[model samples]
Target: MFYRYGRGDEPDLQPTKNWIRRVLLYGAYLDGTRYYYSPDVFLFFFSRLLEENPDSDIHQDTVPLPREHIQKRINADGDAMELAIRILACYSLGIRHKIDLTKQLSLQQEDGGWEIGYLCRTGKTGSRLVNRGYTIALAVNAVGALLTTRALSRNGILIDEGFVESNA
Candidate 1:
């Protein structure tokens, strides 16, 4: 809290801040308890970014690690949920660096819904990610956020904070 409110960016603190900041910020993942591959994990992080100042210099380096999980790890129906989470995370962080939505949107089914992505692995067992409404609703919300971001950008508006907070 002192760092957040005080002049922590002063020259006196720069060296210590740089060295210890990553250890502190990523400590949760380093503990070997938090699985970065989980959508719920990333969603929790994204939720925190909701209140972040757009101009704050928060390190977003760890953010893209989840994308690799979506790309290489998730092959089952879990893609929809995980991919949406990745999108939401990027949106919240205001990264906006050539974010390609095609890969995610392509997962939409012919019935205009999303398959039930793995909520969590039960362990050592494969389960068919059933087509369900919960996943579909989340997908819809994610897509809506993406579309709003695009439209805002086209109109010369920057979602520097995020779609939800920026639009509000």
Candidate 2:
């Protein structure tokens, strides 16, 4: 799907084309491990592909979520990491969102890490656990998104230069 779209060719299955395109373009998928859904992974891979194929038109046009759908998602207080990914995805695809970026920033914990609740299950009883790596990755990506869109500076949010360099 990624190659076909980069080549400006559509897949034969029209019905599944959108799904495949989204998965390749956004790295979004259901029922996957937390790592699989990381926005950093999506942005990194997508940007790499674009760099490798400068002539590709994949970035020329993008499929954005419906305005209503995006608004609904933004209004809901769902997973912070997931919401950050959605926000970044919309921003990247040139979708305009009226939602305040501060809401996302507010999700940051006092410990300087974003919570990514229940990244995995452990033990035979299946107790949910938080993964430090996942939390750090999510926080880094969320902040990266804010920086990419210039929201941090525009909103007068000051981040430590060292932190940004290390994460970035």
Point to the candidate with the largest lDDT: 1
Query: Which residue segments of model 1 deviate by more than 4 Å?
Result: 1-40, 43-78, 97-100, 122-131, 157-168
**Across residues 62-144, which tens digit of lDDT does each residue of candidate 1 receive?**
44443333233222233777666555555554434323345567888898887676444333454333446766776787788
Per-residue lDDT, model 1, residue 71, is 35
lDDT value, residue 19 of candidate 1: 49
**Tens digits of lDDT, candidate 2, 1-168:** 455454345555444545545765453633343444333334433444444444544444332323223334444454555555555544443343435245556777798776764444554555666665675575566557656545554556743231221211
The C-alpha lDDT values of all candidates are: 0.51, 0.48
Report the number of the highest-TM-score candidate.
Answer: 1
How well does candidate 2 score on lDDT at residue 79? 58
For residue 19, what is the lDDT in candidate 2? Answer: 59
TM-score of decoy 1: 0.50
TM-score of each: 0.50, 0.46
